[model samples]
Target: MQKAPERLIDENGFRLDGRRPEEFRPIKLQVGILDNPDGSAFIEQGKNKIIVGVYGPREIHPKHMVLPDRAVIRCRYRMAPFSTEERKNPAPSRREIEISKVIREALEPAVMPEYYPRTVIDIFVEALQCDGGTRCAGIVAASLALADAGISMRELVSACSVGKVEGQIVADLFDLEDKYGEADMPVAIMPNLNKVTLIQMDGKLSRDEFERAFEMALDGCRKIRNLQAEALKRRCEVLTGTEMPEKGSLEAH
Candidate 1:
């Protein structure tokens, strides 16, 4: 077997991007962007960019898939042909199918499916760009889109990736780190309930290392949750033509 690659962390404990072990890349979110979709959102986490649109809670085609006691959740995750370094085929591959299934499961727990029985809720995620951790980023965007569309949810979902590089756990792995890291784990959480919705790990890690990485992922999820809420509030204000109250104003108080 080939020897392990060089360490991503420098002597000073700074990673290639100059981030510390616990630091996450800046994340930005925009909600209610698409005109036709019931809910839509866009997100950028580091170099990965994703757009999510939610439709239905309206009707289900194929008639047979409809549920009597709850709504069915369907998801499609696709990476654009130009999303990565190499040109990719436009057709959905096995990887895309698996991702779609996982993403649907990740968001299902937060949705109040029983409220819209006999209907279907569809989530479509498009990856406009990819560096690393695109699946986790998609989860964040899709959750926001559901909220923007006025879908009832038990809680907002947030997701982030954590990786161990050179014996240190880092939050939000970038391209280089993700490619060469010792271990990679992506996690999604329902922040209000402090419950994990989805988690997957690749590469070997000690039990202790796994616990540390998990905790780090939770912290990252909390931060992303704040950003998600802020985006939704701003979108609501924009749609209602209402200005945000001043920090010390009575409305704010």
Candidate 2:
């Protein structure tokens, strides 16, 4: 581990970047940005940039791998060579493989796999930049891409990471904080259904601290969910001349 900076948080409780414990980095979302993919979306959160493309509900290739009762969901997560200060190898790393699988399973609960039996839904997530929380950001963009593709889903999934930094539970951890933090916990949920699709932790937290962090993460996801709705609404406006829903306006805007 890299040596911790003298302080990750100042006396005023502001983070190194000047954000409060509950604040997230600025986030931007764009949906249906690609012409060829069945569905696509992009997300920029803090310095993490990711694009997701979805294809399918089409026939599954190599028939034997197909499930008779549901669609097969596959996800590929890759960080571009230029994504970070150090050039990443083009070949998928074990971390990429693991993150891809985590993202796939996280999204599966929201998708109605039974609606497209024997078909496949492939999600491609490309990380153009990295700071932290790339996996959660990928999950956010992938859910939007799947929706843009017209896939049947119970609800859109949203995700965020919270951690104990400098003895404080903080929301939306950035790269440096996660590096030196005591604990990092990521959570994903189908907000509308109040269902948790994924939860993973690195390091450890006390029971009370973990509960607080989990709730903080959920609040962040709900905020992101509102942003997702706004993106879809904008896409609808452009494509079909639909008006934005007043009730769906983002809380943090």
Best by lDDT: 2
C-alpha lDDT score of every prediction, in listed order: 0.89, 0.91
lDDT by residue for model 2 (124-162), tens: 999999998999999999999999999999999999999
**Candidate 1 lDDT by residue in tens digits, 80-160:** 999887887999999899889888888999999999999999999999998889999999999999998889999999999
List residue ranges in candidate 2 displaced over 4 A.
1-4, 242-253
Q: Supply the TM-score for candidate 2.
A: 0.94
lDDT of model number 1: 0.89
Root-mean-square deviation of every model: 4.3, 2.5
Q: In candidate 2, which residue pairs clash?
A: none
lDDT of 1 at 226: 83
TM-score of each: 0.93, 0.94
